[model samples]
Target: MGMEFVDLFNQWASSYDDTVAGKDPEYREVFEGYEEMLERLANLSKSPVMEFGVGTANLTRKMIEQNKVVLGVEPSSEMRRIAKVKCPEAAIYDGNFLEYPSLLTPIRSIISSFAFHHLTSDEKREALQKFREHLEDDGEVIFIDTLFKDEAHKQALIQDAEKQGFLNLARDLQEEYYPYLEDIKEIFVEEAFEVTFEQLNKYAWLIQARKGE
Candidate 1:
């Protein structure tokens, strides 16, 4: 198995919500800026929203008040199972981002939390294309993930991981993610979506891309 995403999540699901989002992380601070970004993307009176990877109800808990309806889509069965506890009222889907119109209710913003990076480069491009096709001209896509400084920086993270039980896990994850981000950033720039790169602690890259008509 490349990485048992389901099993990894299953191990963390019960306490995942509290550890990742509930506590004060840079991501939580990033949430503070999203409403301002809503104004930049689509200043709509009412627009349905979707979270492609709503992990442990992290960002959803913050965004619930902004959008009329928040649809959370998570592929991890463990995450899906626990999401109900974090966000009982918000609609939860035990699947990945569904193209079905019934699943997405005319969304203005499609956002995810540390989830998009789990895909491969080809998957990233394909997913970005899908995001473009689904979004309206003015709609926006928000992707939150990690961006390392360089190979040495990544090695440093792996070195640090040695002290933790998940040293190999961290190494494997870094192997999976770091290569494609630069290419992805270029793609975003070419797509006419204003891209500003920022460091959100260890796990950075809060990308905001609006569909330009």
Candidate 2:
């Protein structure tokens, strides 16, 4: 699955930004909101920032524009190439979140958009633990992805997509796995990370978590 996704994103790397611009209104809105949040976070701190699975470095470009120090961890070479062109000033690492070492210790904040849902629930927990281990004293990790309460909610999304005549998209959604809301919350509790979940819609959410002092 990992290698397949790497190949898929690599294939889509060139057209990734354009494809994002042409997405349906709902998904576009989520990206727009994510951009706003990324900008705000960049403006709020001058500390080092890292983006996991930064395909094309869309948000990382925004941070670079604000004069923030940024690092991008991307497993796809093609995606990393585009991201380098887009955010040449930022550092780019070749790896995924779960396996990547702490390239920058005491990072101010870790951010990922639309990429984290690729991880399974256990992987998510492991990734979060890694985030905590690499964070600064007051650091946080922000995730923006498709987060659902359970399988029922995901099924509803698939049904709605099919009803709207997006059969292929619905099928893709069916194949993708999303972390359960309750399970994520429980993991946060067990990890002692103070987490806040902001639901953007039935399918999208923003998770902001900070390690306890």
Candidate 3:
């Protein structure tokens, strides 16, 4: 991750939870059913998990509540500080998706939420390859994030944001590496993973993938 994103997240650390809780009208739709999405992701995950971009530890808290052993990696120090306070039992480290501390145990489930879009398509692929290296043979990779059905769908969303006069949201849509569904699937397949997607809301999709036998 770049220093700009780290700084951006560091700045967002204090109010990031509020934004996800519907406090920001522009992003409310993006985070609608936020708790449900986190809960579902937690439920789908297995113990000895490694979570990338574990911002604020919201999902980490859920996993810990379920008695899952979790190791969280985050790029922003502020986010890590907040997450550590929120999820003291889980070991949260300083790292990004493509680079993180080594795990002692083979991770049974690798997970994340609302953070993968920070990575470009190639970065995402590299992260997936690294995940495959760390996961147990039958382990899964689960994430809930903003993903579009296709390029046209992504463009439509940007247009809608602009039409609604949400310049920030529109700019986010245009600037972020929010990926196309087909592209994500192709990367997973090429990386030898069988993947599936379930739409949780208009903006977020739950992606569950496992290594191909």
Candidate 4:
């Protein structure tokens, strides 16, 4: 609730979806891929899912209709509360990547959208390990976010966002991934997960990985 990064998102939670609905370029080709991937991963109607940083419950609601019992985790209480209203049918938890909620039972799939980038590099690695430790042997992860090619981009992002204020919160809070592809790969490779990156548009893309099933 008090985290600077979290607080910023919480403050924007109420209008998060509308603010991001169509602005992002990473969303392309993801819906079709995910629709098919859901069946390939597990029974969408039966598989349980945990959405990290499920702000405003935009995608959470969409996934739930496909039948995966979705549980969302967001660090911002303001975001979580707003998400709850948007996704009344799904369960949402207030927590950061460093911790998990007691309510989360067991999940076969963990999904994140534009959320993972908020973490520091160390936190990102730890979170990947955390997922490996907690996920079922065959679990998979789907992440979509804005990745930086190098430090220059990272700094530019912060500066750009600072000038824009809350409007640039998502871009402002980000982590670095040199050769972005490999860095993302490291996040899940050890867990027997494979990476696939799709640059939907400029500065954004989708990373889909699957664990050994």
Which candidate, 1 or 4, would have the higher lDDT against the true structure? 4
- Residue 111 CA displacement from its true place in model 1, Å: 0.7
Root-mean-square deviation of candidate 3: 1.1
- Please give the distance, in angstroms, between residue 43's alpha carbon in candidate 4 and its true position after superposition: 11
Candidate 1 displacement at residue 34 in angstroms: 14
| TM-scores, all models, native as reference | 0.75, 0.88, 0.97, 0.73
Worst 10 residues of 3 by lDDT: 1-10
Better of 1 and 4 by TM-score: 1
List the candidate numbers ranked by lDDT, top first: 3, 2, 4, 1
Provide C-alpha RMSD values for all models, in order. 5.0, 2.5, 1.1, 5.5
Which candidate, 1 or 3, has the higher lDDT? Answer: 3
Runs in model 3 deviating more than 4 A are: 1-3
What is the full ranking by TM-score, best candidate first?
3, 2, 1, 4
The sequence of per-residue lDDT tens digits that candidate 4 reaches over residues 132-159 is 7667777777776677656676567566
Residues 59-86 of candidate 1: C-alpha lDDT, one tens digit per residue: 6666665655777777777887677787
In order, candidate lDDTs are: 0.62, 0.75, 0.90, 0.64
Of the two candidates 2 and 3, the one with more favorable lDDT, higher being better, is: 3
- Give per-residue CA lDDT, model 2, range 107-207, as digits (tens): 88888878887877777778878878888878887777776778788788778877877776687676765677888889887887898898874556878
The positional error of residue 17 in candidate 4, measured at the CA in angstroms, is 2.3
